[model samples]
Target: MDTAERTLIDPTHFREVMGHYPTGVAVVTGVVDGEPVGMVVGTFSSVSMDPPLVAFMPQVGSRTWDRLTLAPALCVNVLAHDQLELCRTMAVPRPDKFDGVDWVPSTLGAPVLTDAVAHVHCRQQSVVEAGDHWIVLCAVEGMEVTRPATPLLFFQGGYGGFSPAGMAAKADAELITAVRLGDRARPQVERLASRLECEAAALVAISPDELTTAVSAYGGSATMVEPLGQRVPLIPPIGEAYVAGAAPEVVERWLAKVGPNEPGLVECYRSRLAAVAERGVALSMVGPGARSDYQRLHEALAEYASGELTPARERAVRTVLAQTRHFFDELDVLPDETYDVGAVVVPVHGPDGRVAMVLRITQLPAGMPGRVVNGWIEELRTAAGCVERDLVGRGAQQASDYRDWWEADFPM
Candidate 1:
């Protein structure tokens, strides 16, 4: 059978068939005449990672696509679930699409939707004409993620989610910050926030109104508070600092100056809370270490919340929780080994043209608090050059030195 003839399905019938597949909504934006312009698309997708690239299909008849061609670059904004109306409005060919939307232009003159779940600003790399659409491709040159949250999806003939609990990938650096918070120093949380340059404004994971109300009590202002979703805080400059790879000294200094008691950290949190007021999602981890930690906690919570925590798993979790709680209760009396025993992992590039471990510290059977104090001595030995010392001997001293460095750099 000829292809067209054999598959002569009616257009109305095909709508029912095609509507089963779910797709995400995104907006392709760029600047024209110094004013921002954009059109929403349901087909935007990431195409490559090594040399970052993305692709989207724009209807051949779209005027927004036509205007987009004039710009040398463009930005793709991934809409969140709450942005359904925003997507619907931009999807149509509106003369002033930015009427109710907020955005800013990028270095390449692309319109980037403010605080999209994720956005990529890129320069036009190439384009190809498909049957009824144009395949727009671009090479990513710059990007910024305001926060980590669920992406809005569109599929079939209606809007929906592929999975019951939508999932997303988060930045790795943010995950580290969330793990640090597991230390449960909530009493001095404001102080922790200062040391970290950010604090998590969280509420009981329940209803939106309740969450925000609780958050407000904790000195956090709530905005677009979702009933059941992870809403991370946005700590600027500090959050952006992580992405820029700021110097350790700068980060440490900032950490030292900000904290619960300090006006600077408190002001930073309050300022962000006020900015996001009643918008999309409230209760962000603003400031101290906003960017990364906010992302990590959101992802972890989203993942855990979406799935049913089995009784066995719940029991195990509770056990760990209790253990951690007990550790904190007796934190002062805890043996040095109990407090410090792990290696501080850092990502670095080495002489082999690949990343290699530069240093590590381990606890010893000996009762010496030497892990932090003597650890520095061993590190100095390496300063001269690689000293061929046994793991046991080096770990005891180096581990202590590592603690000292951390204390000096980010004293609690």
Candidate 2:
């Protein structure tokens, strides 16, 4: 053999070494020989969601790949944490990988592991050569999640599960050894918690055995706090080791104590909500205790803030508020318990064009010199650069149209 040729590793040996790096496991299932057939793979990944597509790699000379390409439809089943053994069984040289495996035929006649966390059915699209593997692209036509389970993880040539959020997931070797040194690091953790507005940062429990697992695998250390009156686990959500969402005033306070980085602070606030949204956050409500009703109020106001509250949404909000007001109005209280409420449209222009009108609802602080109208006018002037009467007619029409949609969809 030539010297250069001898130095190059064989595909088999290279694959074995690459296996050490670890990857998520998935099962690519399709109809073969008039029956469902499948192979385990770790290279499956999403390609796109618009017009939906998915892709995975199959070894170039794989007979399974050849069979899969002939099928009309395929199912990619993302394995759960306990499916590592199934993946290993399918990886070996075997004629019947599904002989004793638990699976069910999907609607498309593709094998779907009964315990898979999620399964997506797709039509075969195309295949392209990529190094020593054939990249198989498929158009996802149908999908289902039969089970909800944390995923399996492969790393360092072995299988493992993920730990809960926080330091357990990403702490390095130095942090581990430092923990063994004891209470010396407690102050730092407390400082971190105080700064983060979250408790339980100091006594993080992690070990070498814990590092091999995947994300959200193990829970954090058991620690006690006075407010809770009991010992609780402290596992911060992922990436919170750096910073989290805070009010501008809170951020200013943190900077005063710990100093600040201009770029990092900007990125922290920008990325916090953006990342959470990506992770499928449904609802978020922020404000003071009394205004906890802000979410509903905001929705109602947002409808009209553009000067277009559909008559239906506006009417619904108005009806609800009216009912509450009627009940409160009937009840006897000190100083006659007078309440002032109203809405105004103030135009705001930035470097761009007209942005929005600042909407405010103020409960008057009794015995004041000025009437409620004065407060409303002062608020509108400060909230927006320009006050426009045009808002009333334009918003009323839009609100009427919106009311039509709400009436049709939501009968209440």
Candidate 3:
């Protein structure tokens, strides 16, 4: 080291800035002296492929690292998003951390966690002395992705799972456009939510099969908050308003997912879309008897939001949603009839009259009169009209341009 190169860096500032880079979470476990030993590490990474090598940096004075050094081999269990508690248990400094933990011995004689996304069995190959840490290199013996789920991550002193921003059918620039449109609707959404005493949100079709919440506002007793980028499935009965004016092929592809178990439901949903197109707004209600069905719909939507479902799981989720079709039953809105409003949906259109975005209101006061719910629908429609006019002022979202962008990024 050159004397001129010596520089003093503030430890707190260094840690603060470096914390911005997220790292994968893993628990290194090994059996030593007939006892299981484990410690959580956010510094796990592969260092070489030619020699099948990996490395993790442990604090220089870490007692857990010191204890694990005696083991013949160690296994790195990549934690899944749902294993934060498990990670905390392994991270604690204790002698009986593995008690009641489900695990088995790996091929390299190291403890492999049962529900980890992956297990990498390795033996220590080199211990490089680094300032304030030990760069423990390992010769990879075997590795396999076991559970294959979204891995847990550490960022800015907190834990969160990966939400793929690129999971949409549009590119970053187009997504920025969507956000801009959402910004145009933000004020209106907030105002409508306040006036209606409910939740209001702007949703954009990121893909044919999914729509992400671009903006949201809550008022009154509405406590539900939709994350700005939370994606919801576009299956039947869920997003009819978003696609009532869509191209025939787009609507057809959406309807085909209605499932075959109930043959009559195909036309029923088809009529629902037609009604949405005619009324220019979608209306649904949850009666006292149907509240359980409404909760089931919400649960199914939450599962779809995870974006981690396998084909079988996705099919199962779709079935759950399809079975809730009775919740979206047609409403004639008799003025004197009392209704428990479920949601109000209206569309924001492009220049060519294509359905581009949707405004939805949910979590409303139950047991409202049909006339009151009708007034709420009018408010949502007016807000959607304002956003549409604002979008026109920007001269953006021309159907040709939007279609080109969508097709270029993701084939329809």
Best by lDDT: 3
Least accurate 10 contiguous residues by lDDT in model 1: 205-214
Ranking by TM-score: 3, 1, 2
Q: Which ten residues in a row have the lowest lDDT in candidate 2?
A: 209-218
Models 1 onward score TM values of 0.43, 0.42, 0.63
True-structure lDDT of candidate 1: 0.45
| RMSD over all Cα atoms, model 2 | 20.7
Per-model lDDT:
0.45, 0.47, 0.83
Question: What does the lDDT read for residue 136 in candidate 3?
Answer: 95
Q: Give the winner by TM-score.
A: 3
For candidate 2, the lDDT comes to 0.47
- Superposed model 1: Cα runs more than 4 Å off: 1-7, 161-412
Which regions of candidate 2 are displaced past 4 Å?
1-21, 164-231, 235-412
- For residue 382, model 1's alpha carbon misses the true position, in angstroms, by 60
lDDT for each residue of candidate 2 in 341-376, tens digit (9 for 90 to 100): 211212222222222111222222323223443443
lDDT of 3 by residue, 29-57 (tens): 88888888999999999999998999999
**Could you give candidate 1's per-residue lDDT for residues 144-254 as a string of tens digits?**
766455567777667753222112223333333332321222333233223223222222111100011012112223123222223222122222212112234433433
